[model samples]
Target: MALPSPPLFIVFNASSGGADAEQASGRVGDLLTAAGRPHEIIRVRGDEELTRATVRASHAAREAHGAVVAAGGDGTLNAVAQVVWNADQVMGVLPQGTFNYFGRTHGMPTALDDSVAALLSAREQAVTVGLLGERVFLVNASVGLYPRLLEERESAKRRFGRRRVVALLSGLGTILRGGSVLTLELSVEGQTRVVRTRTLFVGNNELQLQEIGLRHAVDVEQGRLAAITLQPVSTLRTLWLLIRGALGRLDGAEGVDSFAFDQLVVRMRRRVRWVKVALDGEVLRMPPPLVFRTAPRPLRLLLPAAEAEEGSA
Candidate 1:
């Protein structure tokens, strides 16, 4: 399970999840150096810098037949995956985020040393990703209240520091305060229906869905995506649903509806040119009707030897 012989291009985001970029880079560098594996550390800051860095790393990896490694949270991994997947180059991960859903789902280690060691003996596997229009989301994508929640969560993390408690409180605050409902025309599996809901969340990672007690995780593993929506409910009811989710009991919760689909087309009931959407963990405004489906091609992810073996078995 030796990795590609070319030098690894590591895209390290310093600000993500309060991680010390220098420390992470040093440790990763040391591991690779000790293995006599050639590598480069491309440190980046902010969304713009991350975009630029991934692109640069993708090109270098492609030319040298190396792999582009993402060393941050889900957002960083998403950014790096967008470039590396498009370029048809293999990608690796070093989970440094609060919830490394994508990494953990694929059995990528979280500790820097273990993750680096895993990568050194990793094998390539084709991984499914979601596509919102042409954009790629490795874990999940959503619109309506969910994206707004992410925005508030990011703000809270900035002010209160990045911790699970802070994130939980921020999400609770956002849900309690309430947000506008979306009137969406959803077309899935040859059926079109209009529904009013707080959010429309589509999940690609079984580990994430399973964490929330969603049965559709099995669907994702079977090469389909899972879509979830909340029926319009009072703020208190919403809070209850949140609690249910936290307890891993959301499977049959009231005011919640979920299903599996190969592709879904969504249009707002009201005429609107743009809608706020969250991909992975980053929020952006995208044009409607938003088309949610599996990427035409899968990402060639570098997985640890054990995980790779398990997948084959």
Candidate 2:
């Protein structure tokens, strides 16, 4: 017997990427309606409202096990996932962001209408999620240069507009500026190790590795995270590391270290109370020491039929 389709409630971020949220939401609604898919759209002006709206929407339509769709970028998706993770409801994505990493990682279409269609026909699957306290992240999380680069991107967006080119330039500038070195003590599998590096990156999504052309270099979905560190080095050497990491040659890259672990506790040597971290491309000031671990339960993600099969395989 064919299963009934669940109701969909979309939460749109007005300032996501560089697109007009209302027009995008309207397009999604029009397409879904024309295709006989019933849904409700809630357009939000700020990120703070996404969590509340998603939770409320999910509960209001609990009888249907309605799916809550994030109609924006990875950050917006992360916000929605925080409310829906481990719940009885499912989660969907409309990839309307600069990178659209999470959505694209799950085989979602870039075009708004196509993404909506994909969601309506998507298969449900269990996917791992990374958590820091109550917050949930679909991709990777990092401390150090990554957060600084995000901050730089925002500053550049305000100065040179929100074009991709400007964001690229801003990233280049950030890279050239270098970053602070962090001394981290990591505890994993009843063992402890200390290291110093320019950045600490923890990832749970293998799609990110593939996106960077490193599919063969790392696997992030094996019930563990691919933790990578870029050790402090000269500017030229750093660039080399970046290129090598992207090409799946990170194992031989100088000043780069990679490992896989189920749970990690990172403590800063300085014992700072708070640290700036970037999760799924969004920057936040979080208190330390940061506890990193994969949620034991997988998030129920909606993926296209083909993508679902591929993931299962």
Give the candidate number with the greatest TM-score.
Answer: 1
TM per candidate comes to: 0.97, 0.92
Clashing pairs in 1: none
lDDT comparing candidate 1 with the true structure: 0.91
Give residue 270's lDDT in candidate 2 (0 to 100): 94
lDDT, candidate 1, 109-168, per-residue tens:
888899898898899888889899999999999999999999999999999888889998
Model 2 lDDT-worst window of ten: 210-219
Displacement of the residue 22 alpha carbon in candidate 2, Å: 2.0
Clashing residue pairs in candidate 2 (N, C-alpha, C atoms within 3 angstroms): none
- For model 2, the local distance difference test gives 0.80
The lDDT of each candidate is 0.91, 0.80
Residue 212 deviation, candidate 1, in Å? Answer: 1.0
